[model samples]
Target: MPINTRRSARISVIGLRGIPDVLGGIETHCENLYPALIRDNPDLDITIFVRKSHTVTITNEYKGVKIRAVAAPQIFGVDALLHSLWCLLICAFSTRPDIVHIHGIGPAFFTPLARMLGLKTIITHHAQDYLRPKWGWKGRLFLRWGERMAALFANHIICVSAALERDFLKIYPSAARKTHIIRNAPSSIAGRQKPDNDVLKRLNLTPGRYILAAGRLEATKNYLFLMDAFKRAGLDDMKLVIAGTFVDSRPDYEEKLKKQVSENIILPGYQQSEKLTQLYKNAALFVHPSHMEGYGLVIAEALAAGLPVIASNLPVHREFLLPEKCLFDPDTINELVSMLKRPDYSYFLHPVAISAQKNDHWHRAGKEHMRIYRNLLPNSAILTPTTR
Candidate 1:
């Protein structure tokens, strides 16, 4: 699609390694979101800034939205910080997007910079990263500072869940007026024709015979606790299948988690597309023992797949999941183990899960987001014809 420079609203997205096929929460959220926004709103011009490494094969556009790759160091934690700084400069100098929307707290450090450069800034508070166990004292302090700066500087702040919105309001009471709640939505990808038989057969698995836990192999995800709980659950024949590989930031923790895996547990690293969908569809139960989440999007996806879920008892998880019985104490291995031992609830849960799925559609989320933008730029869409 040609750039509609006459359109009053020019929103640019930063933060996230990249999109289309990335595995993280923010990446998947953006990949599903912008397409819907472009389809629903005629005069919106959106651009996403991605890391160069992740956009090697991709062109300069995705689903009518512009894609710009900013140079980032290959280093782990520093990559986002550096990319965000570069993005701030790029947005200020050349792109001059009306709203420089930055995702996650780490990147939000540069929100003040974007604002200073005469760019209208919006920061999406994906999570309070300081709370995660992976970060050390300095990293935690930086993230806490980033959160404060984001709240202080951004023209608007969007919290992914009501709980997150409340958390921010509690800390920065002045930000209450600017902060808005916007929950994450699942992928727009429809289920494949059928579960690929070759994929399942190769893994020595059958439909509804295995348990699935999919997410980054990191400390916050608490995959170690899930693995231990699966062993203690005593379902010898029933396998516990884990998806997602370790990111570069946590090699030691990844190896430590791997050391605890038993024979009954299958580690299928980073399953995506057809394989991931099949895992969700066929699993007896979807287990997520995450210590934290801005919003537990995987739980929503599991519910969408009509798979029974057993998740950590986090407030964000509760926000999406109605049944209290499905939640377990994230710190307590016994609780998760007991939930794993319970009788299959697929028949009882199918209808409820499907209902929840219907409400959490990408189109609804996109419309809500567009509403926010419209409120900020009321005259954003003064439609007029142009001849090339």
Candidate 2:
């Protein structure tokens, strides 16, 4: 709650399915990041532009950050681009924000548009979507173009993981000077939810009798890989709970995953309530076998909840979880099976989980963003209510 200046910066945030615990990494990032920014810096005027399809109501604000909804197609490829363009148009014509901070590559395609309209621009590369299996040739190409545009046009680029910063620099060497690394922070709500056994009873699951894997049921998420490892481990008494929904963009993959999973596997779809919280709290272990990530938020969440994590041996995961105790090669079922078969989960409890829980705070992340915004607009001050 510090005021750094007298003039307020009007910031318009774009790119996301939507917020208030939507079922994606970027949504979770926005949900945690913006609220903290608002609570700590009253001088900053923050408005988030959202996709209308993601929500049921026309609410104007959330946790003091204004919300502006724009029509976006529910389909996959078209949704991000079209929604971003619409948000850009509104920022250019109506809101006229001092800083237009766009999240993710798809929306970064509009960075040039924001700059052309005399708005300062910032883009956060949450993940390299082009690397994900869900995207085809055209989608990948467009995302690549988005990276190029963001590198060339944005005033500054923020990467949620150091791995992303390295990956972006490999393709856009010129962006090295402007790009920055700011890892996503966990919300205070991480371990605050009261333990609910009702969730276990309703799902016909017993406490501490299940391994958890939570992410959108997509190919790149590699949920099937986890299933294979679990099957090979042959922990029949221990159930596997896959807690995410298929977005209909990958219907074939979804159907295949459903067919492939065994009797003990649970697909509860997307969960955001006490059930999800309870799942995280009571799980015997948390596993993430994603082929790619900007940052693994769920892994961090699991660590925060004091749940042991067994994740893909990706650099991003290692950045948070200890290399020796928390990872296995994502491509090899044998490595994952070995990890699953290990009887002791205590190795993940100490320094690895404790470190993640300690550092992944929204307040720290908000302050970092404030520093970036301040550096971008050195003379800008906080906006008073009268300015509206």
* RMSD in order of candidates: 3.1, 3.2
Provide the lDDT at 173 for model 1: 93
lDDT, candidate 2, residue 92?
Answer: 89
Model 2 bad stretches (over 4 Å): 1-7, 56-58, 378-388
Error of 1 at 135 (Å): 1.1
Clashing pairs in 2: 6-381, 7-381, 7-382, 8-381, 8-382, 8-383, 43-382
Candidate 2 lDDT over 87-185, as tens digits, reads 888888987778889999988888888888888999989999888888889989999999899999999999998988998899899999888898877
Kindly list the per-residue Cα lDDT of model 1 for residues 1-388, writing each as its tens digit: 4444466578889998887777788888898888888888756789999998865346688898888887888876788899889888888898877777889999998877887888888888988889887788998999999999988998889999988888888999999888888887776543457555566777888888999988778899988888888888889879889888776547788778878766678887877667788778788888888988898778778878877777888888878755777778999888788777776655336466557775677888888887777666635455545556
TM-score leader: 2
